[model samples]
Target: MNGPGGYFGGCLTALDDCLRGTFGYTAPATLLWRDASTAREHLSRALTAEGRPYDLFAGTLQVLAEGGMHVTLA
Candidate 1:
């Protein structure tokens, strides 16, 4: 992933930078560049067991808001 419109996935460095500028959480505790199988497992963990999306979305919104970032949802 690169910056605004990366093809594979969102650039986590960009996300971390966004969070740093906003809520003071930076650099990341973990960054996983997964192969396809591991990536599926990761998604499963987030969507079900950890429920990461529900927890993360609002905080992400806040970070983006604080950073004055506006994205068009298309």
Candidate 2:
């Protein structure tokens, strides 16, 4: 989606904005995510500000789905 060395921020909000065409790509797109299992495993252990367990992988998928992106986990 982005050019080489292009950055669109690291937070979910930024990801949502990028999916909305804020950076360039349009919504309702398709994404082939390779090695998603590893990402999921790591993100699943993430924590929130209040030290609560946060499923970042699920949250990220939610954001992507909300942005109209169909993700295929490989």
Candidate 3:
């Protein structure tokens, strides 16, 4: 939650509010903010030597999350 609402006032609550309003249900959602720059740096030097752009990966995940199968990020 932002400002004075603490955890209850932030994005998760916002999501819950939205879902409750739109679908007549409220549920928790896991939020994952991956450290992509660090990931890319390590990936470039170690594993693949080439890594997919952060946006591509994030967008794919976004699509899956919005697919309405009750998937939650971790």
Candidate 4:
């Protein structure tokens, strides 16, 4: 995790930047997401800027995968 006000980004573009080592960590990383199911349930109800329904959990997983990161949901 980032330290001292470090931000991992709130949107996909920022997440991509962080995954690229722009924020410090690089890709091909492993993420162990505890209570991911609960988080997913909440995040999946999010909406986009256009007021369209979006599956943030799935989207995040896709982005992480695209960045070569292995995600383990617990």
| Model 1: per-residue Cα lDDT over 1-74, one tens digit each | 34333332264346646455544433333333236454444443344245544333444444555545553322
Predictions: Cα RMSD each: 10.5, 2.5, 11.6, 2.6
- Residue 30 lDDT (model 2): 88
Candidate 1 residue 18 Cα shift, in angstroms, is 4.8
Question: Order the candidates by TM-score, highest first — what do you get?
Answer: 2, 4, 1, 3
Better of 1 and 2 by TM-score: 2
TM-score of 2: 0.83
Off by over 4 Å in 2: 1-6
- CA lDDT scores, all candidates in order: 0.43, 0.82, 0.41, 0.82
Candidate 2, 1-74: lDDT as tens digits? 24442665588888778777667667667878889999998999899989999999999999989989899999
Per-residue alpha-carbon lDDT of candidate 4 for residues 1-74, written as tens digits (9 for 90 to 100): 33343777768888877777666676667888889989898999999999999999999999889988899999
Clashing pairs in 3: 1-9, 1-10
Report the poorest 10 consecutive residues by lDDT, candidate 2: 1-10
Native-to-model Cα distance after best TM-score fit, residue 40 in candidate 1, in Å: 19
| Model 2: residue 50 alpha-carbon error in angstroms | 1.9
Q: Considering TM-score, which of the candidate structures 1 and 3 is the better prediction for this target?
A: 1
Candidate 3 local lDDT, 1-74, one digit each (tens) = 23222333223335445444554433445445357566444534432227533443443344435533244333
TM-score of 3: 0.22
The RMSD (Cα, Å) of candidate 1 is 10.5
